[model samples]
Target: MNRCYLTARGMTVGYDGVPLIRDIALEIERGEIVALIGPNGSGKSTILKSLARQLRLLGGQVFVDGEELQRLSGGNLARKMAVMLTDRTKPELMTCRDVAAVGRYPYTGRLGLLTDADEAKVDAALAAVQALELRDRDFNAISDGQRQRVLLARAICQEPEIIVLDEPTSYLDIRHKIQLLSILRDMARQGITVILSLHEIDLARKLADRIICVKGDTIARCGAPEEIFDEAAIRELYDLDEGAFDPMFGSVELPRPMGAPRTFVLSACGTGAPVYRALQRSGEPFAAGILYENDVDCRLARRLAAEVVTERPFMPVSDAAFERALALMRGCERIIDAGVEIGETNARMAELIELARQLPGYNTLLN
Candidate 1:
């Protein structure tokens, strides 16, 4: 049996006969959450719209569950797939429940009236998205976040085998974003294939099983999150000449402060992250060190700090690394001890602290 629930072959997509992206091919398995990520206007939405049959494909074809998407009847496709796009069309005098009930149209009788069972599913879907309280409220009167949840409820009530969403987290608060993504994760576990475009690379990294990077007229890269979220890959994918993307944290840092080191930061463990960011925000070129390559601090320092002296993880602070850090420290006007736990393995840290005290303008961050 074919495990791929959705397939796109030679898919060329665009607006008004002009191709924005060309020759796209994808095979998304059942229950996988695939996220499309790229720069704005990179055609992520265009690809999604074409797949959902909202836009006419300039070329190629889409298949859902072994049936060609274009060949499926409207009702047949509605039963198998649900799409939640960004365009919100308001209906007159319709309650949130009424909007969600529209999803039941495919399952309803010829008169298009929802049955009690359909209402129950609508209520359940609303409850799932924590929007049950808005069920009686006018859809047009709700906030964007609330409306997004309600629309998600509408899609959920459709009971699709696959769901396609475009930037679904727009206008949602951080909490709602988490809640919505959690709901999608839950849905995927139940064998619902989820395809969505997300501007939040961090959220995409966390939520997507596979990530498709849409760039410059084609699908540039498509693979597991681990393969797609590398520092170099993300930097190249987004054309990030400024700023740095940390794959480990799924975070982006502002460009490093220009010029020579002004402050020397001594830190270990994860303590240096905030200091690094603070220094970056202040546009202060800083040197940080005696950090292990695997240290969380080291990861960020490499991006924000003008100079970083790193040692291998689980190894004692080496003499060469200490010398390099000491050289950087001597050049800086101020030294900040961002705190470290003194242990037998890194006893050299104590020596560095003692040396820092001899230098002018040395301060400890910890109590």
Candidate 2:
């Protein structure tokens, strides 16, 4: 018995006469949600398009439930897989419900009138995406977010065992993004496999059971998010040298200002995070200190601060660390105290605060 619902073997994909990615082999199990992540122009969409049968596969074998993709009839393919592509195409005069109900065409007999069961599924799909209000409205008249939801509903009503979406959250607001992804999560739990490409690494980290890294004319890597999202992996995958990507938070930070320190900061916990960004935007080289290597503040400071003085987590601030921080603090012309909790382990923070008070220009950014 094979639990593998989708398999790609020796896949070589590209547009006419040229291959962008080659020799790819991967397997996706039933009900698992796999996310494709990579930097721009790395062929994420090209791969999705090939898998969805929208483009010619230069060379490869794609199997859906052990049946070769090319061997499947159009109707058979539709019954097994549903795709929501990146392209936005709308038909004139078709209502949202009419567009959505089209997914049932594979299941409909000749004459194509909507049966009660088909209509019920269509309605349910629309409601699932909270787009039922637009059901009667013209598809071309809806907003991009609404249109995206309708397209998703159309895919849902198809009720295939596998769903592939490419950058589905591009036009959606944060709320709608969460709602759509939650629905996809629910579907995967109910034994439907999902493959999606996301620009939102955070969302991918949260929702995907596995992540595929596409890069440089091949599948760079593929594994669980934990394996693929460490600082080194992300930096290499994205070829990022000027910015920092935090695997823990799935957040990205721009390059810090270069050269000598212009500002000093007193912070701990997560309090220093905003100050880092603020300093970056202001184009001021800065230094931050007395942060634990494992602190949330340290995670960000290491990227945006010219010098970040760090100690091991759970240890008291040592005299050497305090001296280093003080020297760096006095070198700066401005000081910002990002109010943090004063606890036994970080009691030396009080000394930094008094130092901030004595500094010529000092203030608390936030409490």
Candidate 3:
């Protein structure tokens, strides 16, 4: 069996002698990317700091490469693990290359001079993070996304066996977020252990080889993302309402159906799939109106043998189409709007909502 890179047994973490993470047990192996996630103030950061040896454990032990963490010297610990903390304060006038070079300090001589090999490693790290072009730019002058990439480069330059990042993507945009995580995934594949804290559960689910979900200062669930993302587990951990989390898409807030039905569903586009499926499962009768040929929901509606009033490709909503949709709604006990993207041109749908609101016995199920 491969030896674990980091191990914690019966661990309790806290600050100023007050325990926040209680009796936690976890093990990370080489080449694994572990995501630590939880609600705010749930001690995810505290647990990370404890693993990085920034905070003393209130109880239990943390082991790196089979040695107790507390027994390692500062330099020894530095060589074994590199930490990219959440609260990084950039110094004015410092170049990006200068900041990344600091990771070489642990291996440098007393004079703090970078040797030829050190420079090569720094350059390689910058290249790895796609920040080579920003190497000469001032750290404080760069965007948050660029600065985050530089920080990651600095951690890579440390050449440690393990890297711990606290909210590494917090400062990045969508593009940079994907870039940074892709780089981390590549690093993990190269046999380095990677662990990070994340607020974006979807990203965590996609990237993490293992997930450690903390809730109320304890381990709520810890396993593969597939195992942890079940409805019961997510609802319990996040205190979400029933039907709030969609297992297929990992969305927390499901669109609600507004007003009572009279005849059938007049929904088109992908936005209507969830509501259409729900209504079908509930055995409620619905019809489809003014469906576009390419809309997936229209196909589903057709499969369900729903009374469909369809239009030709790229055709305008004719008088016949409008009449058909209106006729369907007239028979519906209620009308439902399932996250249909409304625009100024879609004012008729808004009018439908108003009309439904004025009708007696109309109600919406707020999920």
Candidate 4:
């Protein structure tokens, strides 16, 4: 059974004694990665800062492993938790190695010098983040992405039970983002609980075991990724009246073309996704048809196309479905065959193709 590693009871957080968010409640299990996602200025950073003790709580309390957070000494808390905020460290004349070694401060002697074991831990942390090669370089001289990785290395070196990061992937490129997330996933498997704020909702869906949706002064909702990541929920969460979000792909599509469909596309399997996007980009209202309900193309077409004529899954195109598709095709200014294969179940598609060829405005991407 999983244990509650961190808990917030009626917690209120903000800055300067003003509550930005109030009556917040959370229970985070050990070894879980919980991501905070919300629109900008929704108090995600404030909540993280308060939990990590960087900002004082305006009301309520936080507990870690049954110990009240405020009662713990600074060093004791640091030993139990590690934090890497977005605030860039601008220490002059400090090497990357020197910055990473700061994680050992809570464990170091009065002189604050690193022992042999401490040095090894720092080296391992840098290597874990793929920054060992930059250890001797000047900290301020590296790029923002590199600095982010180094800071993560510092957090890893701390060896705390819980790690809190704010926008950890802000400065990372695609490759580095993957690398860093993979490292955090590995760390969590070894029983380190992870908490962080992410602007990338798609990434949050993929990575977090649980998600906390922060909005308008407090947590709007909190649940598993499956419960929180869906078309309606995500659309409402971000107030997306302009565009569409697809949970299957974790992608956002531009608002669908307006007015009536100007083009009719016949596609099946996975072929129509690109064509649908292309038509959307060209601002051409389009329709897709003769697709089974379960076809991958049907999924995207429903989002981008003005109309979609769909048949039942695993069933051949019925006369009713074919008539609807044909009606759409006849109304379109142009008919496009998007490389639908003539197969046992979908053989009626060939008839549609022949009719399209007879029509005046006919195009086939098969060639």
Candidate 5:
């Protein structure tokens, strides 16, 4: 059974004495990756700062491994928690290796010098984050992505039970983001708990074991990704009235073309995505049909087109579905066959192709 490693009970957090987030309660188990997500200015940073002991709590308390936060000495707390803030402030006149060695402060002697073991830990951390080559680079001279990796190496060298990071991926590119998150996942599997705030809901859904929604003045919701990543929940959470979000693939779509559909597209097996995107970019009102609900094409179709004709997943196109599609096809000014494969499951699609060929405006897109 998993044990609660860190928790907050009715915690109120903010700058100085003014509370920005209040009545927040959360429990995290050892080795679990918890992601805090919300809209801009929703106090995600404030909550993380408070939990990391950078900002004082306005009310209530936080606990780590059953010990009250206020009761733990600074050194004791340092052993239990390590924090990396999102601020882009860079250290000057120091090498990347020197910065990563700072995590050993809690274990260092009065002179704050790294012992042989401490140096080994720092070297291992740099290696873990794939920043071994940057060990000799100037901290302020490195790119944001490199700096982030170095900071993560620092946090890892601390060997703390819980690591709190505020927007760790803010400056990272896609490759570094994937690499860094992979390292975090590996660390968690080894029994290190991670708490982080993220602006990317897609990454959070993929990486987090549990998610916390911070909005207004409180924690809006908290649960596993499956419970919190539904379309309605995400759409409402981010107040997305202009665009659409597909919870199935954790993708956001541009608002569909307005007005009546003028074109009909027949596509499947991920082929519709490009056509849907092309139509969307050209601001052409469109409809897509004869798709199984679970197909990748169907996912983009519902978001980009004015109408999407879909059937149950794994089932062949039904008469009712075909009729709806035929009616849509009749209304369209042009029909573009996006070259869906003739297959056993969707052999009924042949009828639609024949109907398209007889229509006045029929086009087939190749490749």
Candidate 6:
């Protein structure tokens, strides 16, 4: 089993006399990518800063390698851990290589001269981030993504046991985001502890070995990504609106349709189904409308005994089919629009929504 590299025991962090993260208790082990996530102003960054010794702990303690963090000297701490903050400062007349070399300062003697070994490590770090070609370029002149990578290279050059980053992918495009995360994942595999705060929950879900969800100035949950990404856990942690818990996508948004109801459901492709399932389970009368055979929702409608209005294989909808569907919908006491997908062929669903919106008793059941 891997040992814990960092431990927070009853940690309280905040500004002045006010505490933002109270009684926070978490342990980070070696060879793990731990992602800190939550809503804005929920103290995710605050906790990270506090762990990095950038913020004074209001109460409790943080331990690095079984030693009290506050008791560790700056130089000693630098050897044990490195931090990459999101904000960048303009360092005068420094090339990217020069800045990354600064990470070796803790190990250098009074002269602060780089040994041959130090130079080689700096080169390796730059290459690790794919920034070697840009080593001669001015750090201040590079794009935000490049600058961020350079900063990460600096931390990697430190060869610290634990690395902490604050929103490392903040300014990166999708490709750079994936690249940066892949680098971190590789670092964790090499027995380095990697902790970072991120805003993108989906990316966190995909990349992190462990997840810590901060909310209301405290940790709402901490576990494997699979454990924390559940609908109830995420909905409560993020304070999502009702009907936002989506099991399939692990997001709090529109509900997806399971299918048409047994009585009858008049929904089309991409129409969400929680409402349909709810009505079906309640034994309400329902049927499904103008369905294409291959549509997922249509398949569900068929299973539920929803009088399906379907078309032949790969054929355009006929006028007779439209009339039959209209007649079936007319007999229902109420019509529901489940927010169907819109396309050239499916635009008729929007017309149906519009028509329902104008009806005397039509209602919408949004997921």
Best by TM-score: 4
Against the true structure, what is each candidate's TM-score? 0.95, 0.95, 0.76, 0.96, 0.95, 0.72
Candidate 1 global TM-score = 0.95
Candidate no. 4 TM-score = 0.96
Spell out the clash pairs found in candidate 1.
none
By lDDT, the better pick of 4 and 5 is 4
lDDT of 1 by residue, 150-213 (tens): 9999999999999999999999999989999999999999999999999999999999999999
Highest lDDT model number:
1
lDDT of each: 0.91, 0.90, 0.80, 0.91, 0.90, 0.80
**Tens-digit lDDT string for candidate 6 (130-200):** 99999999998999999889998999989999998999999999899999999999999998999999988
TM value for model 6: 0.72
Residue-level error in angstroms, candidate 3, position 160: 1.3
Cα error, candidate 3, residue 70 (Å): 0.6
Q: How well is each residue in 97-146 modelled by candidate 2, as lDDT tens digits?
A: 99999999899999899989999999999998899999899999988889
Candidate scoring better on lDDT of 1 and 2: 1
Give one clash count per candidate, in the order shown.
Answer: 0, 0, 13, 0, 0, 12
Query: In model 4, what is the error at residue 277, expressed in angstroms?
Result: 1.4
